[model samples]
Target: MPIFGGSSDSEDERTIHHTPKLFTRQQSIHSLFGGGKFADILLWREPKIASTLVIGVSLLWFLMEVVEYNFITLVCHASMTSMLLFFIWSTASDFLNWERPIIPEVVLDESSFKHLARSFHARFNQILSKLLDIACGRDPPLFFLTTISLYILSIIGTCFNFVNLLFIGFVSLLTLPVMYELYEDDVDTVAGKLMRKMRKLYRKVDSNVLSKIPRGTVKSKKHT
Candidate 1:
């Protein structure tokens, strides 16, 4: 049997294992998030790309949330601004006898598009399968956590608009992963203690309160 519920070396699976562990099979923070260019960007391995992404998202959040700009309106305004600038440059180049501006053609690769579509399809199926498993009580802990999470999100929905919520999530994405990576062991220790306390509390409730609840007993009817 594999230790900590991890696969063999041939599987190329790496998992974090130490005292006071909350998640037994959980991969490293980097590996948990796909562990490539995306992981690098999220973990700030490439500071330039990560900062650019943060700045872009922040600018979008400011425009959409604070400025109250509609998405379509924003796109149209940006497009018009670009066209105006290009027109001005073209006219100036002609007047000054300089070379006209060249615009690069943007083409979507067929292989890349197919790969993206297949990835989405697989991910969608995986999520649906997981939901089915959870609903079927295959993972009681996961089901309980999912229910609580949805309930919290429902409460949050009433307090913030979709754009505001997305911006908040984006901000969290930029900050949370890096912070957790920096203090992984400390966070795990705290989480492990909390989990143990919660388990004891749950056991008490199950024995004292839930166990006392009367369950309906079914009777079979017989015909004479």
Candidate 2:
């Protein structure tokens, strides 16, 4: 049996002796900061390995909060450092008589350019059509269509506020998945208990409140 992922004694020993914190911070840090070869190995071998990007991004944003650094300054610094490194690498390459190409050549002739343009145009139109379909409720009920309309309006409102946009990104991309990954068992346990309690409460509410409340007629669109 294989030592990496097999149901053998060697695999168990490897897990215990080599990397005890396989799902913890040490593993994540190694995966991120490890060189191109390390990353390539992970990609090639365990292509479908679970990523903790949400938690990673959340921690990054937290660090950003503590440091209180200017975004523009950080961007400028990164740009300058990248350019300087490129020049230094080129100089070293020449001095050491290294002949390997660092940057790959992109042969963007007229024909290729036209193809690229067409691809972009097609994608744009496809996305536009999809958005229109969602907005118009191509197959969904009017209630769901209204929900979609409100969601789009909410997004438009959020676009005006940078903080709101940042929070949305944090919740949607970073916090949600990471939180789910880290506390999945706990979350499920809590959810199960909560659902049981909710079922009881729902039954009570249905008997006591809902039965007494008069139902109102839902206004429907008249057929043209």
Candidate 3:
């Protein structure tokens, strides 16, 4: 299924006349990676980065296995301790003129503050509405499939390591959007043809077996 759900009127077009019919390898790589034609594809591909990151971290796990090193606990303690001390180090001279303060200065006037708050509230509502649509509505062709896929992923999350899930999602995020964008125009015709074939197959199946099946599921219960 295409990663991004929710379709528009423009998506129904058989062909994107502006897009070139022929696709080259470099163009494909560049589209996904955001690189020059000559740039190394491995540098931009998320799977490669995620895999390498895991392999590198596996060395620490290997150390723990062989040498009885407390690398995992040490990492947690060291990171938290370092961050705490580092923040204290920011307690310095001048009018709180620390070079890298975590918080930004609040310089807004009352009107500007109200405007910013209103803007954020409006944006949040828009996002919430879109999320509701994606969760419940099947207006988009991929909506039901995407929803089921995510539900399955959540169910399986407990079986895998956090890093594994992170990498999986990281790769999906990096590749899916660009791949769909680059090939969407070409895919329309293929999707249409495939749908036609599927409909034909379904008609035969329906006539033979599905039509005879009871419609018990379709019946709604009334609240007393």
Candidate 4:
């Protein structure tokens, strides 16, 4: 019996039997790992660390500002400031790494990758809607506003004293995660949706072109 429009029962059975189960399992594993598994881990972990660093540095800066002039205080403040600056730089670098492109070729094919990408895109869109609500001053986190305020304060404090340096550094460190959250949340906006659709179309076209080229030709051209 022919199923769908093409293969007979015997042909279908042979195809099914010949297909490697290992390949299917490997594909599933690759998809799970490649589709933002590490990214999610980093995104979740970095923010908490950044937030803690920001709070600690901000408190130290506040203490330095309140106390009178003293060598010990100055030394402590400077050390804290240095550590805070290091954290800020590290966090920024990590953010850059997070933004690095995940090439689609590694994990997806023309037949199934498009569907996976679309699902992620839809989830991202939902995240974006939530982010917009936060940004609009409706049930927004106090910590978010406080973080921004402290960052501005730290910048201004820099003009008057070195203590503010620590504050600025910490706040800057915190900002990276905040920005990421904002971006992650907005993945479903009109522009984001449009971009995803365009990319999907391009991928489909590219896959079609590749599919038409004979496999033997591709191998020969590569060898030559």
Candidate 5:
């Protein structure tokens, strides 16, 4: 069975649409991640599956972080445990004249893999293109925001390594979305107020500092 379940909606239909808001612009939290089965999982629309996912992640964190098991060690231990059980079952069934256990065949589907590869390729390229645009000064606000975000991440990286950071992010994904969805109105109101304050600050800075800077005029070149 697939770990992450599939959605009924096609890939194109997975992209969600949202009304424009003062703070979020063209997207809300639900729509930002793409609204479908995946969004439902993130938002806890299916509480049982969401809870299972949370529990599983918590167990993995405990095993890796707390128990300090390396990836290879953990995989080996799990495989040994599984094989031992299967061995016991097979022997016991033969002795007891019981039906033999049937092991399910696991196969990788080519088409599904190709589809996933294509999706990843497209998304990766899109992100690279957008980052290039921001770097080239095509979007000043986005460029600044990206710079600040990376700086914050770098600071955070000093405290937690990549694995710990990934764990934290995974836990947050299983939490923050549902919480925001439950309290959407209140959260949006607070966000709007915060954005207004930010805008006011920006305007003050523009007038007091940026506007005072001298600008050189661009001269038109005459064609020879």
Candidate 6:
């Protein structure tokens, strides 16, 4: 009769050993956001809040641009337009499921918050890595160059146009809300609860330490 077995005992051992390597290789790529680190916390905890903020600010900025078109200089208009475009593109991408973050909804207790913070740090590092990769890519050299050029152009443009300067100033102000949202999305998740707790603890400790320090120790030198 023909041998039913595909391989000898040694062959089976070798096959088993090689199979794991294949799995390991596959896991390497799939493990980029392993262990619930990239879960969609923002969606769970404050979807409405985030959605409203993004939509509201975006609409307001667009309206301001429209209403004050004549008041803004060309350079400032360009800068504001660029910022608005970026915001629209980013929001649309999130909506389209192309580059949406996986925010998890975890309770924000002290221990959990710390873990979330670590995960956020890891996620942020990954994002930075991807950004650097794109910046250095051969096909995108112009994108990086244009960013630098735009800043310089914006400065020169602002110098000649008060409206442009005002638009740029408004863009700078908008950054605070964007950053706050990002922080909330990253830290207000289940895995990041430990970090929030640690922050509170740290603040409490700092307060106590400050309270212990004598007020008279802070000397204000008189400038003549």
The CA lDDT of each predicted structure is 0.72, 0.51, 0.53, 0.50, 0.69, 0.49
lDDT of 5 by residue, 1-224 (tens): 11011212342133222212433245667675556567889988889999999898888888999999998999899999999999999999989988888998999889877876776687688678768876996434445556888999899989997778988899898888788778876666564444344445655776899899999999999999
TM-scores for every predicted model: 0.75, 0.37, 0.37, 0.25, 0.74, 0.23
Question: 1-224, model 1: which lDDT tens digit per residue?
Answer: 11122222322223223343344535788876666676898899999999998899899888988898999999999899999999999999989987888999999899877866776687588668778876886544445666888999999989998888988898889789999999977887676544444445655776898899999999889999
Worst 10 residues of 5 by lDDT: 1-10
Per-residue CA lDDT of model 2 for 1-224, tens digit only, reads 11122223454445444443322233443244232433433333323332344455455565455565566775687689988888887888888986634687977689866766776687588657656764674423322434666799797876656544674565564334445556655654554443334445645766898789999999998999
Q: Least lDDT summed over 10 consecutive residues: which range in candidate 4?
A: 1-10
lDDT comparison, 4 vs 5, better candidate: 5
Clashing residue pairs in all predictions, respectively, total 0, 0, 0, 4, 0, 22
Residue pairs with backbone overlap in model 4: 125-188, 127-185, 128-185, 128-186
- Give per-residue CA lDDT, model 3, range 1-224, as digits (tens): 22322133354233233322222122554443434321233333455754565566566545555555675776887689988876676766234775755655878589866765776687588656656765664333334445667789889898766655665665565555556656766664465544434444655766898799987767688999
Whichever of 2 and 4 has more TM-score, that candidate is 2
Total residue pair clashes for candidate 6: 22
Task: Report the error of model 6 at residue 44, Å.
Answer: 8.8
> Highest lDDT among the candidates is held by which one?
1
- Shift of residue 167 alpha carbon in model 6, Å: 14
Off by over 4 Å in 2: 1-63, 98-101, 104-190, 214-224
Model 4: CA > 4 A from native: 1-48, 69-160, 184-224
State how far residue 66 of model 5 sits from its true place (Å): 1.6
Residue 125 in candidate 6, Cα distance off native in Å: 1.4
RMSD of each: 6.3, 15.0, 11.0, 23.4, 9.5, 24.7
Point out the higher-scoring one by lDDT: 2 or 6.
2
Our model 6 lands, by Cα RMSD against the true structure, at 24.7
Q: Give per-residue lDDT, candidate 3, residue 17.
A: 38
Distance from true location, Cα of 174 in model 1, Å: 2.5
User: What is candidate 6's lDDT per residue for 1-224, written digit by digit as tens?
Assistant: 10111223454445333332211133322243342523222322345655565566556555656555442564587789977877877788877866744456977689877887887898798666655654674223233444666799877885656544655565454444344445633423432333233334544755798467776667899999
